[model samples]
Target: MKTVLVTGANGFIGRNLVATLSRREDVEVMRIDSKNSLEELAEYALKADFIYHLAGVNRPENTEEFITGNLGYTQYLINILSSNQKKTPILLSSSIQAEQDNPYGSSKRAAEEAVFAYGHNVGVNTFVYRLPNVFGKWSKPNYNSVIATWCHNISREIPIQVNNPDAEVTLVYIDDVIETFIGSMDDPDASYISDYHDISRSFKVKLKDIEACLVSFKSSRHTLVISDLKNDFERFLYSTYLSYLPENDFGYDLEMKHDNRGWLAEFIKTEHSGQVFISRTKPGITRGNHWHHTKVEKFLVIEGEAVVKFRQIEGEETLEYPVNGLSLRVIDIPPGYTHSITNIGTTDVITLFWANELFNPEKPDTYYLEV
Candidate 1:
């Protein structure tokens, strides 16, 4: 089991790290933030496998806020971790602009330098990941991201103004960034430099186009940079960037066919064996060479052609059957029955879905065999 600590426990990224990491069974975590109001640092930070230092201001109104809230908090974390005397990995989440010309960027750079210096002598595996703009579902409004504000405008039908549409910037999904940071923990090859470019005005996106992606808006000017946005809405622009793919798996049942033309019809999933369970299979692919102790399943071929082979542990086995018929197909496997399917057609293969019960990770009822 792993015990990790996340500093800056109240902020957007901090909350996200907590929620996401909590899903894993083997991980135990500690969160530090202003809400808890803990005065003792070393006691709060001891005996953790990793320390993700994300406690700091996103975009401070003045240099003083940056110093006291951002750098100061990080420096305090260094003292606590050093005093703890444990060889835990410390991941410093810094912004790309930290060392750049921006005020927030400069303060971040200072903290990054301190982290490196601390790691050199403190016996901690210190590493830094300077992330670009991170956007996704559950993103807080207070975070510094223009993309979230845009999304808010989309949801609220608020009028949007534009300034610099041609500035170039990079944007990545918040989930992806989290995966990157999580993957970096305890990396024996921990290095010093990690750079990220997020969706800021650096990338040229027309003002109307940004609004068009989510909603319709009236704007005379097209696009603008972080500096051009109104100060009254200073924090609004820092919302996470939006992407085409929704965070969850769901959409309309429309064919919504596009350029793929003849291929995607095969990849769609439309079959079910239980009340509700769905998965996709491709042409020339085979699945489920195993048997369930209590799982009885049926597959309905919705597209392409498929052939299934079934063998009962204490009974006779059955030969393959043609599954190319677009009509519903049913093949129920009794307990201790083994089966698998293969696509026999040239096009993509798809099946309508269903399952008797939800799959349980802790108590899987299935067993696999190579043959």
Candidate 2:
């Protein structure tokens, strides 16, 4: 079994990494945080087979604390391992800011240098990741990532500011970072670079575009319209946005249309994939005595029994498909065919329907006819 040591275990990336490592039966994890003593850190350093040094300060009150938190702690760990003649592989989570000349950047750069020097002098393997803005579930809102802050505030109906809408920021999803880190453990040599390694998958987006996507997410509940998730950046951003929703606000009421036959409600609507809706029909009730010119649909009876009847617009022959909740089946309603569904059972019949196109009032391709 591999014994892995992780510092800053309570922070965002640290928490996610630790959780992933803990799920493996063959790997043992040793976590050290602010609450742990220096002696504990030294002990873990001595016994660790691999170390993930993720502890660093970016928002310290004083400039001096940056060195103490980022460089000092890293140097201390290296010293402990060096004095004991241990050559454990270490992975340091550095930032893109390390390229700048700011206090935080300087401190992070120093820490990276220290780790590289230790690796060369002591013959230890080192992996340093100069990561971009990382955003995901456990990230702290308003602390570091603007995406996290916007997700939190927008989900709660609070206004967010976009100081420079044209300003662009590069981002890497937390999951990708974790996957890369775990991959390093499995193959340390492959993760090495001359100066520092980088997460392979990253996105560069404008502030205005991000705000627009986030705003659309908040409005989706009422419109029943889902954003295009095929785009990798939007998909990851949407997932991050949902992770900040208030616990009690996870569910929103859907608009249901009531009639003598039963009630129907739209579930999801998409531009490319069309729409999906659910409906219930009372016993002896029939729905959809109509035929479409170009639109197609699929009917699924989830509860009770029903008979779906279809007749070609140009023919006299009628086709029938009997379906029930016990034997779930999908009956495709083809174009140019009049179709109707009758709830033959005693109880109400529940069915799900999917269409190829969104219903348009101006040019409703539907024509009423008897099946």
Candidate 3:
């Protein structure tokens, strides 16, 4: 088994990386955080086949702490490895800020230099990732990532400030970063881009666009409408937004329409794929004596026995499909055919339905007819 050491095990990226590594049967992980003593790090360094140097400070109380946490600690770790004559391959998680002239950037740059020098002098393999704004689950809000802050505040109904709506930020999802980090263990040189290793995928979005997406996510509960997820950036951003929802608020009530026959509630609505809804009908009750001009639907009886009847708009022949919860079958309702479902069982019948388009009041496209 390969022995891997990870610093900052409690941090966002470290937590995700450690979880992934722990699931592998062929790897053993040694985790070190601020709570652990320096002696533990020294001990782990001796047995480590690889090290992920993710421990660093970006929001310190003082400017001097940046050096102590980012640069000084990195140098100390290298010194310990050098003393033992160990040549363990190391991967450092540097930030894009390293190119700037701020104190945090200077400290990160110094740490990168230290790792490169160790690799050069000791002939050990090294990988440095100058990551952009990383966002996903477990990331701290208002600390390092603006995405995290927006997700947290928007999910909780707290007001968020947008100083510059046109300002753009580049982002890399946590999963992508983790995948790139794991890939480095097998072949570090393959991911080299110019001077450092980087995640293959990144998204550049304007502040206004991000705010709009988050607002839409919040409004989805009321509208039952899901935004287009085929776009990679929106998909990733939506996942990140959900990760910040309050624990108790994970579920929301759906609007149900009640009538003498039964109750029906829409579940999900999408722009391209259409909508899905569930319904319940009392025994001896029949629903849907109508035909659509262009819309189509699918019905699956999930809880009781039912018979779905369909008839062509101009034909006298009627087709019947008997379905039950135990059998688990789906019946497609074609356009230009009048259809109806009758619950024959003693108990209420539960069915799931999918439609090709959202129900429109102005242009229902539905004509009442007997089936």
Q: After the best TM-score superposition of candidate 2, give how far the Cα of residue 259 lies from its true spot, in angstroms.
A: 0.8
| Model 1 worst lDDT window (10 residues) | 217-226
Candidate 3: list runs displaced more than 4 Å.
188-194
List the candidate numbers ranked by lDDT, top first: 2, 3, 1
Query: Model 1: residues >4 Å from true position, as ranges?
Result: 38-41, 59-62, 186-208, 216-371
Q: What is the C-alpha lDDT of each candidate?
A: 0.62, 0.94, 0.93
User: What does candidate 3's lDDT look like per residue over 269-346, in tens digits?
Assistant: 988888999999999999999999999999999999999999999999999999999999999999999999999999
TM-score of each: 0.55, 0.98, 0.97
- Sequence-dependent TM-score of model 3: 0.97
lDDT of 2 by residue, 1-371 (tens): 99999999999999999999999998999999999999999999999999999998999999999999999999999999999999888999999999999999999999999999999888767899999999999899989899999999999999998989999999999999999999888983553433588787999999999999999899999998888687989999999999999999999999999999999999998888889999999999999999999999999999999999999998899999999999999999999999999999999999999998888899899999999
The CA lDDT at 262 in model 2 is: 97
Tell me which residue pairs clash in candidate 2.
Answer: none
Using TM-score as the measure, what is the rank order of every candidate, best first? 2, 3, 1
